[model samples]
Target chain A: MFQQAKLHWTQSLHLELFQNSTKWHTLYEESYMDTSRPATQTATQAPPQAQLDIDKLVDEHYDYLFGYALRYFRSRDQVEDLVQETFLAVIEAVKSFEGNSSPRTWMIGILRNKIIDRLRLKCREAEGESIGFEQDLLSHLFDSVEHWISNVGPRVWGSCPEGALKQKQFFSTLEACLGKLPEKMRQIFLLRELDGYERDEICKTLKLSSSNVGVILHRSRLALQHCLQVNWFEEKKARGPQ
Target chain B: MISCQRATELISKRMEEPLSLKEELSLKLHLFICEFCEKFAQQVHLVRSAIKNGSTEPDDSDTHASAEAKERLKDKLKLRS
Candidate 1:
């Protein structure tokens, strides 16, 4: 397990982002996940003196922002910072905020920009430069006529106990496995899977070709499925007949 | 008959836009014989549904925005108002 992930798991995609183990994380503010107090409580707990509507807004939208932020970042601290930064930005921009997009969606758009800036910073840093996007990754998964290479194709996950997904550990594993993906693939996957963005929109936002979007999306799905099958679902089989 | 790779690619393409009769049939036929691909298909469905559901649920982890952070933002916003 990555050192960042070594700490007690707080939630899915726990704090092990792509940081190198050798250096201190002083590049940004120090923070950690604080699930001890549910955000809902914090939002509603707005002091008696706080404006009522702002409290309501925070109460209503904080979880959605927090959840969306978690999907992109592995660190609890980064997630906390992003959500806080988002609301801060919202206060200044809300006045000019065209009601063109729904408020939550608008907030998410701002949050996405923060995420992109962080990722771009990571990109500039020399140590974390490797994105691990293997060019041959997909080709090996298929044969000459595009059939799966039988020796390493997918297996039935025993009908995939959909009910099992409700447990929190599933998200932990899912996020960890997802965190293993190349950053670009991760971005496209989350946009489609979490935000439900269509291909055209993804292409426009990411400046990717439409076909590139599809290929990356498919490849990401394959990688996540393979990871889950190995780490989670296949574990069930491993314990069978034990 | 389309290969599993072609069929899977077509399957994803179908998500983005409508597939032609020829493309759709080719994929369906390939999926029929390809049990593994069938499983892959189902897995994608399961994942998409899971994400949709997961997003709606509250934080199940130990980390969330701190109350201090919330108050801080509110104080700043109050100044803006």
Candidate 2:
């Protein structure tokens, strides 16, 4: 009986080891797959390794880089063009990247300059000084908010018990609601909620008064609440039964 | 005593920042006495949370980038040398 008990323990130990080994192997395979893709197929045509590295850098950071562009341009269609422009600039300045920061940060810095240049071009095309005035006002307003909010403790909403899947659902609903907002109000909402701009800064940037900013924000939030209530909560309630 | 409308405005603004001591005391006192207003406040809070936690699927336009455009961009980048 003792011998049989010892054998059973040994068998269980072996099974546990086998399961752990399988998990480790699965993780290894996943990491390998993730890293195996060449950063940029475009760079494969380039003869130089450094040029290839720069191309790879651009490819890796494309999503967030485009997101930043879309934030400024407020148009998804413009994002691709802006990203292309950013890459072109990066390629030209590849040798000068200096490695002073992480490649992502350096690429973002280049993209920032490109965005400013594009904005300036748009300002010129508008055939009015309003754009320049708005930009100046925006910068000042944002600086004030940054000073105020930077020191305040980060806001934590209630803990999400449902995990990442639910959180993602929440984000998607918010995004849709945001997309449905009127153009000016949507821009203001994004600037404040997503970008963390202060109300004063938003008013100055958009060339509106504090009351105007408040009105727009208030309306935008109300609209979003209405949208979510109708689309998410009501649907859930209906499916849940009386 | 503040009217319901004034109380509602103050309640919404208070959510955005720390309310003044007097404002806080007023809201608390009002909330204690008025069940309807209390329920309204709670509903508003629920709606705010729903909005904050909301998610929706990606639109069709976002789901599939034109493969042709991606190929064209790739070719254009390849030609830049």
Candidate 3:
């Protein structure tokens, strides 16, 4: 079991996000799942074979799982529902958990599956969100003939400094930039970049055609690159370079 | 000839899956002449890794799940398990 003290930064950031944000729902208002279903609706009646410490697991990982789910969903209700669903699944599957991985990792695997299931349900509704704004973003970055515009073209960020990834400030900036992405785009980008889901899995899970997934991923990277540059790299330049 | 826009798309797509022979050649040719697109490719790589690290690594922020939310989840778990 991971100790509570060892878990710190990401939990706090996610706590703040869940408590204070209402804009979380605006991004997918029409498609937010009907989370009002009874929490027991999905729990299996299978008896537990292993003596997994459920309370201790919740104590250590609830916030981390909340934060992880926040990446896929910003709504507090939805995030809570997903975490609950994951724990229920954990209870049923605890018998098969061979301890090859840490409990946290195991729970995360289950939580991701829950998230994918939620996405599959949403995709079934076929809301077909209007991504026309993505076209405007392309025009803003390119000229009429599809060449990069001077002011908006990608700039040299110089080489990544040693241990840049270990820097907390860098992660915060990256998180902010990721938050700026449209929810759908962010969902696809993270499924690829963070969850390490294969592109085919993403297309199948999200009910998007392969080309549509490609286009969304492209737009997301473009947006994230611009946001990171403007918020992190450019700010560093203004401070007279590191 | 692939435009700079097309080159950037291929750059992002290559990260997801392999590009066709024509796409691979055009993107390579575009990067050969286009310093900006070359920089764009590097930036995409940087962004991808940065995100992977930023998300996976635990940090020192002083927050945890609210007691209320935790309690609620516990209650639900008790009901099912």
Best by DockQ: 3
For each candidate in turn, give its C-alpha RMSD to the true structure in angstroms: 12.5, 16.7, 11.7
**TM-score per model over all chains:** 0.66, 0.53, 0.78
Structure candidate 1, residue pairs in collision? A35-B62
lDDT of candidate 1 at residue A173, scale 0 to 100 = 65
Identify the superior model by TM-score, candidate 1 or candidate 2. 1
Worst 10 residues of 1 chain A by lDDT: A19-28
Error (Å) of candidate 3 at residue B72 is 2.5
- Residue pairs in collision within model 2: A138-A205, A141-A201, A169-B55, A170-B53, A170-B54, A170-B55, A172-B55, A172-B56, A173-B55, A173-B56
Give candidate 2 misplaced runs (Cα > 4 Å). Answer: A1-49, A52-55, A63-76, A89-168, B1-22, B27-65, B71-81
lDDT winner: 3
lDDT of 2 by residue, A35-98 (tens): 2344332222222432333334444556556655554565666767877776776555543322
Residue-wise C-alpha lDDT for candidate 1, range B2-65, written one tens digit per residue: 6787777777777679999999888888888888788788777777766666644345554465
Sort order, lDDT high to low: 3, 1, 2
Model 2: how far residue A214 lies from native, Å: 2.1
Q: Count the backbone clashes (under 3 Å) in each candidate.
A: 1, 10, 3
* Residues forming the 10-long window of minimal summed lDDT in candidate 1 chain B: B54-63
> For candidate 1, lDDT tens digit of each residue in A8-96?
11222122221122111111133222335543342223233322246656766777778677767667787888887777776655433
- Superposed by TM-score, candidate 1 places the C-alpha of residue A187 at a distance from the truth, in angstroms, of 1.0
